[model samples]
Target: MSQFLTQLGDAATAVEAFLAECLAEQQANGTPPRLAEALRHAVLAGGKRFRPFLVFESAKLFGVTREAALPAAAALECIHCYSLVHDDLPAMDNDELRRGRPTVWKAYDEWTAILVGDALQAFAFELISEPGRHEDAEVRAGLTHTLAVASGAIGMVGGQMLDLDAGRLPEQPAATIADIMRLQSMKTGCLITAACEMGAILGRATASDKAALKTYGEHLGSAFQISDDLLDAEGTAADVGKATGKDAAAGKATLIGLLGIPEAREHLDRSIDAATAALHAFGTKAEPLIEAARHMGRRGS
Candidate 1:
């Protein structure tokens, strides 16, 4: 467990360093001081950085070096941070805080927040496509395409659209477990799945190995959303680093709301088990990934 945590810390450090360099380069190129600063603020916000850890760990399966995987890992973090920025906009979830700091929209203005998301997303593609970072044209193209699909309308954005649609209808019936699962899969699962898939691309993983990592990500993503819902239901804003109970207040359909806390917890455990099981072929080397799944299940507790 200590070793797994240490790896996560190391992953976070590598990813952050790359992201800092990217932002610094943009600043040096005169990308506008405010825009660069906003990009840095949003991307550098402290978090567990779970997605990047998946990238690094999954790539390790194919003997890929950390430096080789850093660009893709940083790209994933950019997309993740961009989504958070847009999700916190007034037109979206309208949160006032994140990571225990004022949300981009709250810290700056809504327009700046919008631009920050846009710029970060563009930078994500730039980082993944850079020749020095990715080296191989084919692999870089694959990484670019994978990230595009994950963050596009068919994935995270589509899920957010569904979430918004769900709350917009006052007379709508409560969402079923299946409905909630689908939403969670797209909104949160897609990018996380992409992170693992990106690792496979970086390492030239075989079909079977890639499939296993993808499965691990799917279960892990579901567990992550379940854990998030649990935290929002029970945790304080200070501990959660954002407003809690917003989902319930918005009448958002979550596993907890549909299945109750105990059943939701059961489902979370099952997902975690499936996640760990998906990597069984990797044997002892899969410990970090297994620990990551367990960590997802225990986020709020």
Candidate 2:
């Protein structure tokens, strides 16, 4: 466990360095004054950078370099940051803090926050669709499309909408849990699953391998969402790097709210077990990625 954690930390360190570089470039390339600053703050906000780590470590399973997966990882982080920017708006979750710092909207003005979100969203695609980044144009397009679908109305946005709707209508039924899961699948699972699948695709893995990775991603993503809900109930702003208990505070319909803590933790563990099983075919080929799944299911941040 110690060696595996060290390896995971090494990959996370590599991704953090890349992300910091990306943030610096964006910081230096600002056009206006505060707008660029807002964008920078949004991008540079301290977070786990887990999505990128998954992409990098998963690619390593096939002996691929981190550079090969860097763009996708960075692109996914951009999308996630943009989502937070938008999600924290007064019109949305009305958040004040993110990553233990002022949210983009709170640090800047509403207009700036909105534009930063828009620009970051655009830049995510730009990073993925950039020519010559990938040998296969189809792969680039597909990856970019996957991001769009995940972050767009059909995905994250739709999940947010459902979240708002669920808040309005309490006492959600069992089918409501399914709806919540669907929303989360697009909102959260889509990007996470893409990270694994994209890494495999770039590594030139077999179709069977790609399918297996995608399955692992799906279960891991679900586990991540469950863990997130549990964190909202159990964590603090300092530990989570975001506001705590916002779901219950906002009357949001989370798995924790409905399933209770014991049930939620059980679901998360079960999902982790399924995710671990999904990698059985790869044997040692999937160790790092399996570690990543366990990390998400157990780690707090």
* Model 2 C-alpha lDDT per residue in residues 1-301, reported as the tens digit of each score: 5555677566667666766776566657765767766777887666667788788877777888888887888888888889889989998888998767889888878999999999888888877887866778887887787778777787777877877777766666534567778988977888888888878866778888888888999999999899888776787545645554876666566677677789888889999999999999878878877877787666655
* Poorest lDDT segment (10 consecutive residues) of candidate 1: 235-244
- Per-residue error (Å), model 1, residue 34: 1.5
lDDT of 1 by residue, 1-301 (tens): 4666788888898888888987898799888998888887899987878889999999998899988998999999999999999999988888999978999999999999999999889989999998888779999999999999999998999998989999996777778889889988999999999999998999999899999999999999998899988887767445545554777777676677678779989999999999999999999988888998988766644
- Quick one: best lDDT, which candidate? 1
Pairs that clash in candidate 1: none
Name the best candidate (by TM-score). Answer: 1
TM-scores of the models, in the given order? 0.93, 0.86
Model 1 has a clash total of 0
Global CA lDDT of candidate 2, please? 0.79
lDDT, model 2, position 185: 90
